[model samples]
Target chain A: MADRNEILGAAQGAFNADPAASMAAVAEAAGISRATLHRHFDSREALLVELGTRSLDQWAGRLDEVDAEALAASGDAPAIRAALETLVLGYVDDADGFGFALTDHVILANADLEERTQVLADREAVLFAAAQRVGVLRPDLPPRWFGHAIYGLLVSGREAVRIGDVARRDVGRLVLSSLLTGIAQPQNQDSTP
Target chain B: MADRNEILGAAQGAFNADPAASMAAVAEAAGISRATLHRHFDSREALLVELGTRSLDQWAGRLDEVDAEALAASGDAPAIRAALETLVLGYVDDADGFGFALTDHVILANADLEERTQVLADREAVLFAAAQRVGVLRPDLPPRWFGHAIYGLLVSGREAVRIGDVARRDVGRLVLSSLLTGIAQPQNQDSTP
Candidate 1:
């Protein structure tokens, strides 16, 4: 059982790095024999199914901790940053789980997963709307669109970390800065605010 | 030869829509016999190789048209917007070619591609630096990081379009708005400058 959890973590990391990662690679990553891995799981999908089960549980807990409404009500950039950080942390923990959402995986097709995802999306919408009303979120950005962009970065930032494009610690800053401040300098800030 | 080009376009479209798309599906997309597709390219890799070659040529031409130096010197947001639009246009035309960049493929491993990608990145950095120095881009951003986000959006926006998450026409606006203004409302407009 101890080895099982370890193998799952290693598989999550390997699959997150490359969807096409092989069973041999997962076994190698887990520091276990291929036969031992075979004893635990029949195929990649079986491993993924188990991982998916854990993923849904973990994701649900993370979403519960978000306190999105409170953050939105605060309407401070730092508060939203905290919320975004929470989102990023989820990626750091189990990016492979998030990757499943991006793909046509059976995990996404799960009824429970679908409802949870919608719940999360709906919460994000409420938060963004509140923040926008308070003037922290950009007015031009549609709430749904903002949600997707955040979702995109959440998935991509993991790939960046896996490929050594960005350091693990830098993921938060990179995503938040890009999401909120954007790359274009504000006219007000360039000269005088 | 013309039929070959047409088949390639169809394959790109099909693959962009679903990377796991089958040969039969691709043939239907091309409006040709399965034999025709097979006659032109022995395998998906062979087709991808030819597409990769064409992709490199097309990408190089698009980057050249960006006139990064000119846009930077102008220090105009709209000019930068135009350059960004040029990028989005290419993705709309051949998303599968760009998708090759996102995934690990022989196309990415090719030396010519490696060099071309470097060239494009270098040009983009130069443009971004000038824009930041001129106060058109966010000063806090590292120019290269900004370029990657823009590039990421270019590839992902196409995926979004193919998945029907966004309309084909919305790709340009979504990428530009997200890159330029971000999701946060400008402080100047929100309350006081």
Candidate 2:
């Protein structure tokens, strides 16, 4: 049973690296026979679903590592900045896995997956609320909008990196700056207060 | 020759509507025989390249239609706003075609095909320069960065619409608002100034 689980993990890694990786190739990489692979996963879809669930679990675990107490002590903008940096670096390091998860999530059209996403979204909302308390994030922009904006940047930044148009470091800086300062003209920057 | 061009246009429309549409399916939709389709283009890639070239031409034509006199009379921001709306609408309406072109361009690594992108980029640079002159866009944010931001928003907004998370109208509004106002809190809005 443990051996089968290990094989599945290896297969998942191979699939993440190359979506077009054939089952036979994965079996070869795992040093398992085609028969064994078939026995483990009845079909491609079944294998993908298992991989997706595992990937989501890993992402959730990373979120758990974020120290809420430490973040609270540092203040919102800085904490959010740190979190965003962690996200970009993590995604860059495990791009293939993350990309596979993103592409699969899109292809599956599984509204149910939002249950998993909600965990991340809820964490983001908490972060945004903290930023608002610190008067760093715009109080006027709804937290939901802020959360969505962050997600949008992540998706776009990933694509930019993939296309080689933007460097990874630049993406991080751009996202952080845009989220904190905005792009409005300096003259229009006056506050109501 | 004219008839062949018409058939090619029809094929482009059909393929844009459905990427998985077979050659036979495209022929039926184009009101042409399978023989005629094969006679015009030997394969899917050839047909797509022709269509992509046409799409690029159509895009250039739209930019030409951007009435320079009217733009100058209306002033920069409004003119840019009009031009951008036109471009964004065109891309949105034929996202599949543009998407196909994007993917094909990447696969073939066709420099000539990518050169077409520069035409649009040049136009964007003009708009950014105009915004700078009018003091609407922040001087600190490089024009290239501003252009890339708008491009990123367009791509992100399209995906958001695809995912059904944001309405099409709202996507446009959000892109425009984010470009014009940015995401920064009001108190920090002019802190850079």
Highest-TM-score candidate: 1
Residue range A1-193, candidate 2, lDDT tens digits? 3377788767767765565567887888788888888988887667767776676676666566675445745675656656755754554444434555554423234455656666666666676666666765566555556655655455555555655656766776665565455554655544212
B107-172 per-residue lDDT for model 1 (tens digits):
555667667767776777787777666666777655667656765566557556644557777767
Per DockQ, the best of the predicted structures is 1
Candidate 2 residues B1-193, lDDT tens each?
A: 3387788767766754554467898888888788888888898667777777776776676657775335634556645556656655655455434543433322224456567766666666666656655655566655556555655555555555654656766666665565556565566444221
lDDT of 2 at B100: 39
Q: What is candidate 1's CA lDDT for residue A39?
A: 95
TM-score of each: 0.78, 0.61
Question: What fraction of correct interface contacts does each candidate retain?
Answer: 0.45, 0.37
Name the regions of candidate 2 deviating beyond 4 angstroms: A1-62, A67-148, A155-165, A189-193, B1-40, B67-110, B126-134, B189-193
Candidate 1 residues lying further than 4 Å off, grouped into runs, are A33-35, A49-58, A69-85, A88-119, A159-165, A191-193, B31-36, B69-115, B159-165, B188-193
Q: Model 2 residue B4 lDDT?
A: 72
Docking class of 2: acceptable
